[model samples]
Target: MNHNEIGIEALNQGEIEKAAEAFTKAIEESPKDPVPYINFANLLSSINEYERALNFFQKAIELDDTAAAAYYGAGNVYTLKEDFMKAKDFFEKALKTGMENSDLFYMLGHTLMKLEQPKLAMPYLQRAIELNEDDNEARFQFGMCLANEHLLQEAVNIFTEVVKRDPQHADAFYNLGVAYAYLENKDEALEMLGKAVEVQPDHLLALHAQKLIQEAK
Candidate 1:
């Protein structure tokens, strides 16, 4: 296989040094090709070289504006750096390049949520779930967006689905308890909180909520 393909395989196999060497060779062999630069950027990102990764991603974008992967990679780096606005910008650019994938939508939605724009995040998170129904994290985040908007019943329904899919999800149970409490179903809330505590004995929020409910009785 070519150096780029070899680099990708090595990266997938967790051979960091081999992957780096292969990617460097690939870039040297095809300096004008954006794919090598993008691959190298992804490698750097994996190694936590955020600034270097962004530089490589920018070089790839300079080589080809249509390099959607480069934009996505840069967005991820920005997200790690906690630069929400830049992350949002690059993610939106990725979408404009016709890259319609669950991950891209999820990243964009998550960035929007970080920016405190839950309303804008909702549709993208929903679309992510539509594209990949098995993504429980996306579903959970969508439920969070609904809860942020005070859509308690909808949030409870989504959180219930999350717990059903993964019974060990303590946060889902905690959110379910909170939602039930907001809906004034004290018994259901306590039951859900108990489940949360059962799943994660050290869950501070579940413990606190349980204490509050009991003291009120």
Candidate 2:
């Protein structure tokens, strides 16, 4: 029906060129509307055209200053560019614009973690988990942040939950082992590390950890 609707359908079908054409038409029809610009920006971001995507997002913001999606899109582009600090700033701005959701919280948390601000990242990650408990990647990252912050037991608990949720998660097992070792629980560390190696026989870190623990005994 509408160009915007057609663009969204084409985007969902992975027809990027068609989607772009539809979105361009939508923009020409409603030049002052920010939605098409934001949608186009999202498509560009998905294709890794970070600079052009950011420019379109800025254009959306210029049209509607309260457009939270534009800020979120800009933040996602910055994240792809590995500019974690700028990503954090835009994500924060999105939140201030009343765009509060699990994804927003997760991105902010993840960016803070990348910046090595684990303490600052904890609350956001916690909120993200509260909003969406099935995000094992977020859970694993939060566990790592806990371990880095010296919260050994809590880290172990989180890692244990991760392994329980996905038994084939070799990295979760390895992290659990590391957390146990930090707590001086050598036996548990060995057990978890052994499981890690069992799950992924080519896991060099797990093998090394196992060797170190065995020699220390």
Computed on alpha carbons, the lDDT of every model, listed in order, comes to 0.96, 0.93
| Model 1: per-residue Cα lDDT over 161-201, one tens digit each | 99999999999999999999889899999999999999999
> Which residue runs of candidate 1 sit more than 4 Å off their true CA positions?
none
| Highest TM-score against the true fold, candidate | 1
Query: Can you give the lDDT of residue 127 in candidate 2?
Result: 88
Q: Model 2: which residue pairs collide?
A: none
lDDT of 2 at 120: 95
TM-score of model 1 (CA atoms):
0.98
Q: lDDT by residue for model 2 over 137-202, one digit each (tens)?
A: 889888988988998899989999999999999999999998888788999999999999999999
Best by lDDT: 1
TM-score against truth, every candidate: 0.98, 0.96
